[model samples]
Target: MAATPHPAHRFLTMKAAGVTLAALVIILFAGLRFVHLEADFPPGVSGSGDLYTDEGAYSSAAVRWVTTGQWRLEGDFNPAVNLPVYPLIQAVTFKALGLSLGHARLTSVILYLLLMAAVWALARRWAGPVTALIALLVMAVNFNAFAFSRLALLEVPMTLFVVLGLLAAARGGATGTVLAAAAFLLALLTKTAAGFALPVILLVLLWRPEPLTRRLAQAGLFCALTGLGLLAYYFVLVRGHLPDYQTYFMTNVLLRTQGGLWDLGRALVRIIWYGRQFDPVLYPLALLGAAGVLVVGGKLRRHPLFWISVVWIAAYLATLATQNYAPARFYLVLAAPVGLLLGLMIEHLARSGRRGAAGLLAGVVILALAVSGGRAVDYLRHPQYSWASMMRELHGLVRQDGRENPVILGHFANSLSLGTGLLSLNDHYTWKSSLPARLERYRPDYYVTLGGIEAPIRSVLERYGTVEPVRTWDVFHNYYTGEPVALYRLTRKSPLEASRP
Candidate 1:
């Protein structure tokens, strides 16, 4: 009924609207994270998947710090396990929001939203609004990233610092490089495993278009800052406890698994198999984006972001291949680069300026995003925190012995002890040499095991053999491996002799 507007006016209006939507997308996603911050453990059913063990361990440690003013896992000061940054964050959140893990989990949501914002900002600079939106959607909608990002764990927070460091590196100046170096240090301090990322980060200067002397100067200062920071952190400040951190680091994170080339192949295959199970589109698209980066960039040195994407993926896969225990969570950090690659590819495709082709690509991307959003919605509707019935049964059994509290031993000894008001020993952290002696001394009446080497405990308690409890918890700790919970009752042979059987 009205006169048509000019084509240029319409195009400009549409462009402005698109940019507004892109900006709002990330902010809306961040708001969504705060929703259902307290949702979990719908009664009488299984969880979406395995609970990363560190989630509870860190939360429990924070709870201990808040309640008793001790930042410890059980009674030990295992520095590798107690990397000060994330647990400190958890402690701060718990102090503000009260002692429940629900409050602690809010920290992850907040950090993850911040992570998305950082990713969006970086991607927008490298590509444009369309690419940035794609990056945001892929990161938020992908199953693995969505799942772990919401939980209270080191992975998301560590990943955030790593990306922040990269974003700083992209700023392209001496001062920016220094800030980037410092951010990488923060990432390392957050999680020692972040050490694997150092070499790739160090190569940031190679991406710069500076003169040889200038780039060299920047790289030298960058390396000096990062290296000195690590030395100061490990040797200077916590010098007295270096041995404890070293032992835990070597035993648990570094040498926890050993394998050769074939193992590496298997690790890659395992990663692909399980990674697709979470979101079929994300991994495949990321691989395509990586290839697109190389082909389009022509020379590696010219495209800093593109080169960085390739190096990041290659380095991460190499690190994963080296580890025999290929937990899916180990693959989580790749999400950052994957999002970048996706953004780059989407930007590249759009540059073709073919509306039909762009429409096709957009359709495919939208479909993939829709699928992930549906899965996320389904998960939120039935959030899986912990087994509710298992707690009731365990509590009932614990109360059966009216006279005294029964000693409990398990991999989750800290949480179990906190929940049951009993002395508990964490089987995973106890040194093998002292294990038998501790078992002999503690003589725990019941062993509440959550998947550890039970042979030693069984050998030690041969005289008082274990009777399997009524309930066996059906749960997965990692990648379809059913590390079920078992609460076995051990009674001394002399004490319960039933009719000379």
Candidate 2:
């Protein structure tokens, strides 16, 4: 009964709707991450185990930088290790926000929000409005990704840099190349594991439909800049600490290489187990999407997004399987790729005039929201174990003098030092031949025996002195996943100088 609307009017209406929908998606994603943002944060030094005082170590440096105005990695309450960019960010945040674990975690929560937008923007370019929204929703609904965003950890920042770098590199210009190169360099600086995805950035450049010389030029420039940045970082941070760096390599890298062909099988099983992070619905859909891409991706097969996803999944999964393994938080980087792959399938379905595409997408979103909602509720009810209060209490127990805060010596001693502002040292990674001497040299007023691990420390404590923990607390990597870590306090050390070799 009404005249047909003008074509421009229809286009305007659709554009407005798309923008509004995107706004809602981003708002929802950010809101979820911010809720209970400080849940069990600063999880205390070694709160997550394996010297997992990751949050403490980083926060301590930032606090020192801001309070003492010295970037002292060797001074009291300092760990011998260092990471520059992330701690610097923390210092800035603490400088402004008055320095609490909550303020520090704010950085990750913000980065988490930016990461969602970046994923959506990247997908919008690769697929379209519908596929972009689909990808963002899928990523947002991931509970592991959601859960980890509440920590003051480097992984979220590294992953954000990776996605942003790829997005910039895909834009196809000299400016984009430079921005992408910088972002990639920042990722590497955040953690060396980021090197696993370096080749993907180069692929983005070389795969461009441009003259070979131009592509080569851009790729060469990107490599040169990134390499220079890494060198400068090393020159500044590691050149003075060569021995410590070597120890880090031996423990972090060589120890990881201890297995053989049999490990590949174990790695497969481990990765499958880790895939539970994607949950009952999203992961299976991703597998289906991955298979679907090969059969029906059409133009997507030639797209950089497809190749990037393939390369990242292969490289990260391979490395995760082989060496440098840790908790499933390592899988956070894959969230975007997995979502994009699923979006690819949805895009193909929609293009084929399948109206169920809308229904299918809605189903995925609703299911993801429902599942993530359950996780959120569970998280709030029973928070993760925090060792912060316990560490402070133990330090207080044996401190006979207030003029000097008692030193804490054990695994992740840096964290104890940082979190509690007490002198702390642990030769946790030093060659075993020198361990006894290393243990005797510190003469810590107190010693902490970690769970089932740190036999060397326990042996030294036994051989030398009266070791006791006033009390023990139950803790895990996250919400009780692994064995409980034991906390011991060395209440008395009898003539450690006599026990030394």
Each prediction's TM-score versus the true structure:
0.81, 0.81
State the lDDT of candidate 2 residue by residue for 23-97, as single tens digits: 575566568666665445323222235335566654666766665566553423333343467877877887888
RMSD of each: 4.8, 4.7
lDDT of 1 by residue, 1-501 (tens): 998999979977986886686556556555656667645422222232335245555455566677657665333425434376787787788778776545666798889888888877777665667777777777776656676676677778887888788777767687788888888887776776676666666677666667888777877888898989877776654576655576566656678554677877888776556555435776776776566645665432255566666777777666656665555566667776776666666666656565566557667766887776676667677665354345456768877865364666666654543334455555665465655555556666777665543676667666445555645675333223457667777664554553244
For lDDT, the strongest prediction is 2
lDDT of 1: 0.64
Candidate 1: list runs displaced more than 4 Å. Answer: 5-25, 38-52, 58-60, 73-82, 172-175, 236-239, 257-278, 296-302, 384-408, 415-424, 439-446, 450-455, 461-484, 488-501
Candidate 2 lDDT: 0.66
Which residue pairs in model 1 clash with each other? 41-385
Superposed model 2: Cα runs more than 4 Å off: 1-26, 41-52, 57-60, 63-83, 258-273, 324-326, 381-403, 412-419, 427-442, 450-455, 462-465, 476-501
- Cα-based lDDT at residue 330, candidate 1: 62
Query: How many steric clashes between backbone atoms does each model show?
Result: 1, 0
Error of 2 at 489 (Å): 4.3
